[model samples]
Target: MSERITHRLVEVPGGRIHVAEQGAGPLVLLVHGFPESWYSWRRQLPALAAAGFRAAAIDVRGYGRSSRPPRVADYRLLAHVADNVAVVRALGESTAVVVGHDWGSPIAAATALIRPDLFRAVGLLSVPYAPRGPHRPTDGFAAMGGDEEFYVSYFQAPGRAEAEIEPDVRGWLAGFYASLSADTMGESAGESVSFVPRGGRLRDRFPKGVLPSWLTEADLEVYAGEFERTGLTGALNRYRNVDRDWEDLAAWDGATITQPALFAGGSLDPSTTWMAGAIEAFPRTLPNLTAAHILDDCGHWIQQERADEVNRLLTDWLRSLG
Candidate 1:
């Protein structure tokens, strides 16, 4: 059975954070990634709540009803880590299990990295928590990727990506989501430039078509509506701060996430292929990782695409943590 979800605004450091709450017990904070809201965790919320945990999916700063800082620098990883801490504190809990996906993965990991007192356990989906490299992460990207116009490199300049993507929000998001899913990229996936176009609009980088079954027309509209209201400034800003995040995390160089951790990703997710090295070494970086799962025939939208499996894995992990 599904638990009822409640929406509320909670006061935090910079501004109010909008959260979707359900159940009651130990707090479990869900932080969403770019181009998404708290709704990304819709499938997992009720499941966790029914499992006897207080589940709250948060709209990271700059997205959804959360505070949007005017400056891109304000979207730094530490800033996001602070937001997680604040939200946990606001919930009257000294510690909570923190779960994140996409960009939210690092934030959840960082919260566990810097303030384990607050985020007791960690759950990372899609993206793994790899330790910082010796140099700036962007510098490494430049060396490896060259002038390939990688999406992250393209997102460097403010307003560039927003200008390209925000115009046709529905089409852009639909294509973006589809391009990264198992439906589009399968088997021979790594060699395609379709995910990142060279000197072209984001829409040009993807095939023009209907959204996949995983993303219903209604789901697309909800995402489109949110981006329509806020534009892509805040969300894109996350990519903009990659280097800054690298520098900010320098103090904890070689530090590993010591909390009990679990990771889940789609077998066909591009990030899983790209971060193969890091994902393979996740056990080394996260020695406490209890389980790492890859769902077959799944895609980037793991929670939404394989909600039942994800819920089972997540709840099982949560249960083991007790």
Candidate 2:
């Protein structure tokens, strides 16, 4: 959207992944979270380039212009990491600072873990590596539900997430994004994430009648269009590989990332904060972790909700490395 970030098709593990890059210096790969395309980083691309880093944002396996395959198995953890590795190689860089958000955060961590040599540094917005994460992916999901995860467990059901998300994706996404505690999302806002139960059965999760205030009709429409075109099947498939992901990470044990790392958490983000001591456990996963700052004023969409602040943190952190 700004100065037209360069677009190219990167030959990755499965197929050609569409990537957009700007600037020309050390590389920074900005990987986005679920339900988002590379377009989410429109604001940061040029700015990072201006600051002198060859910044690239890519459409992860299932989203945006990148090629999407049919099977949920296709979006496995290893596949995701390999795709990132392929992109890094295609860029002709031996290593790049990898920055990620939400689902991208784990993938970034996994890339640094599964392919440590491929990354020079790591930064995450809204998510971090729990000692349990690299141990096994399913462990994270399982750890969420000590006994029964009526919340996330819903994802495992066949055709469950897809069915629920597709029928009302517009309203769902709009409601989810807009409802994010505005108090948490001051300015930095890109992709707002929230969890809501299917139908009106889980009012406890969405107290304000399923739709929140910030999600405007326009925002809902944008989400609706994307879902309508892509369908939730491919996206939902991400959840299906839970167990398979664990199996893949089984062989890679106790591998802590030694790369300089930056971890940012949204204090109001239930995904991270709700986990109790999870945020504090990050350093154990990275041998050279430097800082872990929780943006007290933000929610899940840290980049979008707190862009200027997030940008400042990232730029400053990168400069610190020099």
Highest-TM-score candidate: 1
Query: Per-residue lDDT tens digits of candidate 2, residues 1-322?
Result: 2355889998986988989998888899999886766766777787787777888999888776677887778988789888888898999998888999888888888887777777888887777676434554455655654434544456666686675566776655654465454452333232222333334222234323433333446655665776688776666667778778777777666567778999887777766666546566555666677767788756777777777787888888887777
Which lDDT values do the candidates have, in the order given?
A: 0.84, 0.71
- Pairing residues by index, what is the TM-score of model 1? 0.95
Candidate 1: segments with Cα more than 4 A from true spot: 1-3, 186-195
Error of 1 at 180 (Å): 1.1
Query: Across residues 1-322, which tens digit of lDDT does each residue of candidate 1 receive?
Result: 3348999888877788898999998888998887789988988898899988999999899988888999989999999888888888888887899999999888899989999877789999999888988888777656655545566777889988888887788888887777777776433352353335456755665756756678888988899998899888999999989999888989988788999999998888877878899888876899999989988888888888888899999999989998
RMSD of 2: 4.2
Listed in order, each prediction's TM-score against the native is 0.95, 0.85
- lDDT, residue 253, model 2: 60
Candidate 2 backbone collisions, by pair: 178-215, 187-305, 188-304, 188-305, 188-306, 188-307, 189-304, 189-305, 190-304
RMSD (Cα, Å) of model 1: 1.8
Q: Model 2, which residues run further than 4 Å from truth?
A: 133-149, 184-222
